[model samples]
Target: MVADGTKRSRIGMGFLVGAALVAQPTAARAFNPFGLFGEDKPAVTANAVAYDLQVQGLDGKSDVLTAVRDVSILYRLRQEPPQTGDELVRRAEADIPRIVDALWGSGHYAARVSIVVGGQVIALDRPASGPVRATVDSLRGRALVPVAVMIEPGPLYRFDRVAVLDQRSDLPFDPAELPPRVVTIAPGDPARTADVLQAAAALSDHFRDRSHPFVKVGRRSPVIDHTARTVDLTLLVDPGARAGIGGIGVSGTKQVDPAVVRSFIYAERGDPYSRRAMADIRRSVARIEAIGGVRVREGTALDANGQLPVEVEVTERPLRVIGGSVRYSTIDGPALKAYWAHRNLFGGAERLRIDGDLFYFTGPQNWPGGSNRRGFNTDDIGGRLSASFLKPALWGTRNDLLVDAFVQRELTELYTSNVVNGTAAIRHRFTDSFNVRAGIEGEIGRSTDVLGRFDYGLLGLPLAASYDTTDKPLDPTRGVRVTASVTPYLGFGDAPDAFVISRIQASTYYALDDAARTILAGRVAFGSILGGSIGAIPASRRFYAGGGGSVRGFEYKSLGPRTLGGIVTGGMSLFEASVEARVKLTDTIGIVPFFDMGQAYAGSVPDGSAPLRYAAGLGLRYYTAVGPIRFDVAVPLARRQGERPYAFYVSIGQAF
Candidate 1:
């Protein structure tokens, strides 16, 4: 067998180069390569130029030399439109070098290849391009490349009985899929290397796309030989199966439900080995109720056919529930409190929180300052309970049912009050990037007027709707959210002439990272009491903005109309706006600094006073799987003679 001029230099080795015409190994069967797939493998004239693929000192004469592998097979092929036999030969002549390298890397160091005249690379049709049965026909023996080197495969390749070899051989590859999630074999036919690989690819894709995203499926080639002109092969495969959950075991971190992680796994005891399920499960081990990122995958495989004893290995995270400190700011003075919380409380994304605070404050005796408070005695205790149910795949979307109940009753020089409320709602996400929500809610409560004398009762039903899609709810990276709600007495006509009450809030955020990891957010909320004797609705019912979650600069519910005597005085309406930059500095920390503007009035700004109240501050946050721990210290820009320079806050998650 003699290669064209491009062959290795027999002369370079200073040896006599004889052009030996070796006998045809055997007549390749008369069968057509394409015909094996039930389509005719068309024959082309063997007219391409013969060439030798030369490598430094390497001889192509030895039968052991095989093709070398290239990173991207497709990239190496120089496409030559097979317009005619001659042109096809030219392309083949040019590609011989790459082919030689490929052959060698593939283990055939001395492979002898000859192109049938007008040789072409044949390819199978992708199922979707056309009918499966007919598509292969249309693509039958079609040339993907012209002037190709091919050993006439006597019997074309077809899958025979497959055997899996591994130290853990008990868990054989799923044979049903031929190339189960563990391995795939090309349909027995006149197969090309690419087609065979396409079959194998499904194994990795199926596993990664579902449970074992991190799994690495390395290639184990099928040996082929056409000496008898019959190429037979065996597939070498690695299960790459990781630990799956055998049976969930629980201990110390029991506050959060283990079921929460179970649902995330979407896997069961009998599920395939998975690392992801365990990771997600471990996140619920914490005490705080928050959102955290987790990865799941099959872990140690039990060498059993898909029926392996899966192991759920979790890397537990920081405790979610933390007994912590609390602090707040007010127009009167600054105060600190003690707090405790159970984050992943009932497990599965539920939260239980409690807080107790005490602060000493003094206020100026003036109409604008809401006068008459020079005191150091202030104490408060409050808590919140929230639970949620999330079903992402149901309803053709991700939907959630949430319920929350809260009470903040306190006795102070300012007031002695009791307030209780419960709310149930539904939230639906239409897209990973967009959301719409609507719900019906009701609240009933009573509280002491700031002066500790005037007591008021309030009852109302509120309807609300919102649209938003920020990366992080509390600290959004991009997108805008609009929320508006109105609470009206069930029957105004039958109830005390309380006409109608309404509140509206809107917020927007934009991501700074081109990747949208961090964001800049701004928000504004305005509310008013409208209807018969709106004043009768009580001080608690009147809308007020401020504190850690609201305006941030002032104390909670402190930004509203009031008298120098610190009474409800009277509230016409309230308006609050704030600008903040939410930075996801790292996976573990987030920070935000903001400016707030807000105020309350009784119909009109008392003739000569500017009703605008402003505060600005910086916040530090610690990121946890359960969201973030927040701390902010805000100061009022315009002090009313005797207000604190700064108000500090401690809480869970971002203020808003």
Candidate 2:
């Protein structure tokens, strides 16, 4: 027999939040809020008594029953025996309202709970546990109590209809303005009470983002039908007045000019209030690593003229830092890198960094910088050192100036060589989607090939333009990124050639689902050197395709034109294409199947005579906070006489 309790009225659905509730389910997982356990009860002290609480008669609604059982205080009382039997009975009696709350949370409003303690019944409506408490106290002083809780969770309530009632006639109202299923409480679905309040807030935010600075969501009780098991909702909204931008101020800046902070703000005075504009400014400020914290506040409430003032506060981070990393690969053995950076060199968001790398401690020296000679040896080693400086906001525009210099010696399929290069570039971002750069570089290098040794100096002017709409640079799931660059070189010494090397590369990605669990990515690139013969251009300057970042199955630069001695001759033209299907099995683990093809032509342009090399590969990725750690192994599908049958690559980022 169940005791009838004084049931509280259901909570009315109404506007409560500043933003409209989207239908997106934000709950990570279904939870039993009352701490219900499927396992045996935990052991208690020998002196302490225990209670066995079982929630019975769940019918087919295990999910709802679990939610109520998990959070029920009666379960807690069992875990920790009360001081007296009467106290245990009292605790159970006082917990009926809380149990009802849990049932409501799961959209079950017509639930009834019956409690039986030691064969004595407890009434939920009586001011106390009454006769059950008296009987329990008389019979047991410090004995274990077995409690059985029988629950009857009736039909779940679902929203039959939902509407927004705009009370003010001065403001425009269109039913279509609200997002589809914003409340998430649709007809025929469980009407979660929380979704109703969330939807109200979402509606308010929708208007606020559109210049309604003082919009308000009012409260109203929803109409609940017991017989039909449905709820009808009407959300009240008071859109105060449309507002415009007012005075803007900046503060909390030290060691950085106030003008620089102000420069990042995109909103203008007297313009319509825009949340996107303000958010963009905040994002830009965060891009400067030196700025650690930021707060954007509306300084004034809506004025008589409907203007809201704004203020931005910033906290500066440490200007300088030092960090390093170490990586090991079967191809390169072990490599160590270290760097120091000054993010605000001149206090204008300028950056300066010095970096160095050392590798090839015990690997084959036959690769670049492995040895000073042409032949392969195990003792060959390579090292690199470089420095770069970047000046942001060049000339008060969204442009940057970069100067870089590097010296290194490395091995390639053709030869072991030493190179020194210096470059200066100016990059201008027209918008988020497009950018262009122009730069001049000078290089001096000496290299040895199977044929002989060569030395040269060169100067070049390089220009590049790109359009990127990818969501993430490290691992993009959607959008296209295209980049094209041309470099005109003037060589000095024996092989003086005024050749223009041009290249265009493009990558496109498409996510197969809303969660981006599966992605299709494709890439293609083409390059050619003009006005110079194969021998005239330096080996390092010529194009070649192979290795981790290129045709994976082939050895580094081994797929290009080759001499009679089987040595790779760097080609005058190059073409490469690849496609990968990336599938994320879990949030942190992913796999990719890829195919690659490339051709390196001896002539300035591919005339179809050069053989194309094809490779197929599988890759694994472990997603991390910074990026994915990638491991890939590939095999040549169309193997050539001298090409390695397989190749493997390991790196810290995506291949593309």
Candidate 3:
């Protein structure tokens, strides 16, 4: 093949030169080479030029040569036609230096390239347009060019020695004394220019992360030894003075008080300056959903007291917002929800929100002229209204206090009643990845179901905690999440009852590839109510599976123990598990195939007596920067009477 390409290149060059030499008549009318009569063109017209690329003088097929050829314009000219043969020659000549540079980038610094076209040695450094124009002036019409690129990649260069010179030894530790945390390449490793440059950058970042924000790295020169085929690098550094926290300033906050903003700072005055601590402060401030943006400025120079002055600037989001959503499904015909919130109530970064939702508004007796109530009752008109308040840094620490009050009337497969409740909770984050919460709640309600009708009052204590190591909360391709909570309730009204409800859930994600285009996700949850009969506990507190967020094939809260009349009486115990493979078919589109199984039982422990529900389905996802828009369709593996053949769901984010 090499010989054939060489022979073709020689012939191609000869043809071009011959056409130019025999072009005296065409040169007289160069401006209009068509014909003297303007319509009588030549019968023998030139064809479009094409080339055969060849790279020689290599021990084997080298990746460096492949990279060069892949990026060569000479090779691409065949796919993208050039106007003339001279233009083709110019591009081929220009690619020689580019090929050499690419070879050097791949660690072959001592590489040579030679370009031969039609048996003529074209000067690799010839000006692109000047000489090519003069040569092509003689040639007319179309022509084919055979090009050969011969490469001689010499011995690869490796690093011999790498050192950094620190001008200021006044710091606590010398650069030489400390461990090499930035140097990536060692002696005898290929001398890649990228690795050398990256090492310098990492070293500079090391000092900046260690409180030397003003540090500067200067004068980087790698001395290359051509004979030994090795590179020795020396980098000069000037690390300026280290600093301590001098003063903290907050600005750009209108509705949020300065004290609220200052509370996020992890470092106090007189403390040694730390970039990590400053970053934490920035993150803490950003997490306050009310904050639109945050900018931190470190003092360019230390103060007279030899400390740094830090400024925290933050823009506040709109203090109030009102929005709502609409949803529908076969189980629940239609539902609408509306909510309003004040992000910075009373200028303390406190939040107050009011929410209202109406469900089954167009079914049975809930709306006029309604008839399709197969899975619903005539009185299943349900609505809820609630108000909640939140205070951050309640005690000048990473703790939050929440207070809530709500009144609701609801109807379900199990029962329908009106209820009112109040709750108070305190949440504290122990670290960036772990947190705990404790709360107390009181309730009063009336419930009417197949069992009977009763009025009840209850008081409860709830404690919960979680550990999250996922890289992202909305969409995670890796890491684990775990949560456990227990709430104990004591009934005080006419029908007195008591129960302790506990739930534990966990999920994990693993990326099958580096790009995170494919992920295997799994989840499992267990919940139960101890020390109480299934009828005694409120229907809202009972455990049931089968919904968009649960076992998908079944209806919402429809998979559980039932009354003799066939009404679903939500169970006292629950267990569920799901596995999904999320594969991104494109940058914005993805597909998920999943399997789910779970069971709800009357007793605390989910014994083997009651059969578990199983479901398998496929889902589609349209990904965006914020999250994915999800659409799922699921069918039961084990069919049941009266249940729909399949279930369909639409929402945001992944199922897990």
Candidate 4:
């Protein structure tokens, strides 16, 4: 009867959580709002109990037979609730049934043999704070957030009687702490579910501290706890102190060594059980070239002696993918780009990507820059290669490496420049919240008919760091990334004019509200050149800030340092800034109304040669099975000191 009861309870609980209320909720996981905020504030209000208590998955239809009621019982462990005020007493009376009903819906209590009542219950809020801290209010000199909260019942009296459940009769650390007061089940006293859970957790953590993280402590609730306020405890145990590899499996594989695949599994023979280590294995698997949605579920088998036989099952996802896009806008005209990438191209090791982007006019439009081809047109074809590795970061940190190369061209120019560039980078993810990346970049080539020179290509090094506490990556509700990098040539090497470039970039995204889920995104980047007949930064690197990456109101490459005649004036550089608000309509698609502002002093792309470009417009994004395809029609909100504000953009990917 007991076993059957537990099974039915689990089934009912699953049915409720899976089939009740809200259909198609937000994505699988939501970034924690309170945690993302600067700091977590107590949920409990000063006089009242709740500051932000979300009654998640609350169902109103199950109250009939389930008779779910939220209840809070008082226990005498620390202190008991007063038999006092009408408000506290009245409120508790009303709230108790509600809480009790809610918990009854909980799987544990759902199938109790007694339909109505059997055990007394107690309800209390467990507030967690600075933990084992050397001092209070200490945020500095910390490697991680040392504070946490947990809810528990029953002061699980420590025990001397504990045995390995697996070994059947194996013994370790005497069973002297066996039975004491409250040794058997008691009525009215809520079962010590929390105590069992906490004990298991504490035991697991104890093993993790030494980095041998592979010890699995298996326990199920009540987990059969017999205890009273004052009683010694006995724990039945399951011991597999050592974990061993059973074998391995593959997902999304072309041709990679099974041994190499096995390496990603941080858990190994004799390793201690560790959730953290398992998580690392998952991340590494996802990062393995050409794979998506990589998920690793781990389990263990027990021998007659209670020893654990480790088993790891793998599920591989797709890596090589091809996709095409079409978008229409006023500024970019009708644009399309085709891309192909192999996450795990040849094997599960390296990354290879190829893209061809073409920009054209919807109609033959006259430009301020006189006879510039029939209409706006440009084409870019590029490929990048990256090899992953871990490197030591400054201050004893470690980071990953990505080395890449690319080549591209200008289709409409009277003078076309074909260029080649290569870059090597090391990025150190210092912690979950912070990281730094540094790299060296170099390029060599011929400009229009500019003579091809390879005198030690100019070196570009970008050093950057970022902090993110947000829950999601691509669709962050709140987060910030800041960067600074410089690439100076020894004067584009003895060119007519010697020019060097330096730039700084900053971007931030914040959610306006959770219920409404509104978002605000902003960006700013400054680029300038120094020295010689060297010439303005190449239209490529000189920095064009107004379009997609900058002020969405502007056109691509259209918004940056430019001169009259819609030509990038021969000298000088520019800085751009923009802010926009985004509203997500669905998981994949959204719309944004934005105001754009920026300018160009030296070089230029079509759209303008003015010192300031102003634009305001609304953009629409359709989230597809593959990714988001975007379209925007922006008109100048106000005429700039020297330019026109009418332009449209259609493209894939976020504006920034």
Candidate with top lDDT is 2
List all candidate RMSDs to the true structure: 21.0, 6.5, 10.8, 19.5
> Considering lDDT, which of the candidate structures 1 and 3 is the better prediction for this target?
3
TM-score, candidate number 2: 0.80
**Which residue segments of model 4 deviate by more than 4 Å?**
1-254, 257-281, 298-348, 354-403, 412-416, 422-442, 446-473, 492-499, 512-516, 533-537, 560-572, 584-591, 601-614, 619-633, 640-653
Residue 5 displacement in candidate 4 (angstroms)? 24
Q: After superposition, how far is residue 155 of candidate 3 from its true place, in Å?
A: 14
C-alpha lDDT (0 to 100) for residue 106 of candidate 3: 61
C-alpha positional error of residue 597 in candidate 3 after TM-score superposition, expressed in Å: 2.7
Residues 1-656 of candidate 4: C-alpha lDDT, one tens digit per residue: 12232222222332112111111221222123323311333332223321111121322323221223223321110022222222222332333334433343342232211010101111222111224121211222221211111111112223223333322354443334222221333333333334444555655554444333355665322222222222122344443344433333445444543443554454455454455555655665554453444555454454454334444444444656777777665532556677776654445344566666555543223332123445433432222222233222223224456666666443222123456777778876645456677788777654531222223235566566666554344455677866665544543553423345666667788777754358888877666666542243343344454555566555455554333444542234566777778888887668888777776555322234455766778888786654557787777666555555566666665566
Q: Which candidate, 2 or 4, would have the higher TM-score against the true structure?
A: 2
**lDDT string, candidate 2, 217-272, tens digits:** 86467566666666676777887778888888888888866666665565678888
lDDT of 1 by residue, 1-656 (tens): 33233332222211111121111223333222222211322242233222222222122323212222132122233321233434434443444444543343333323444332221322211111123223223322343221223432112223333444432453455555334444444334433454345544655555543544344443344333333222233444454544444554433333435444343333457554433344434442221234343333333444444434433333334444545455454443555655555444434445455555554444444322132444432333223333333322233224555565556554333344455556665655443333444455545554455433343344455566666655456555566777777666642222344445666777887777665557677888777666644345555455555667676656666666666655444355777788888776788776788898887666422222336788989888897777778888898887765456678988776665
Candidate number that wins on lDDT, 2 or 3: 2
Best of the candidates, TM-score: 2
Error of 1 at 225 (Å): 38
Query: Where is model 1 more than 4 Å wrong at Cα?
Result: 1-408, 412-414, 420-445, 450-458, 490-496, 515-518, 552-558, 564-572, 582-593, 603-610, 617-635, 645-656
Error of 2 at 159 (Å): 2.7
lDDT (Cα, 0-100) at 159 in candidate 1 = 38
lDDT of each: 0.46, 0.73, 0.72, 0.44
Evaluated against the true structure, the overall lDDT of model 2 is: 0.73
Worst 10 residues of 4 by lDDT: 113-122
Whichever of 3 and 4 has more TM-score, that candidate is 3
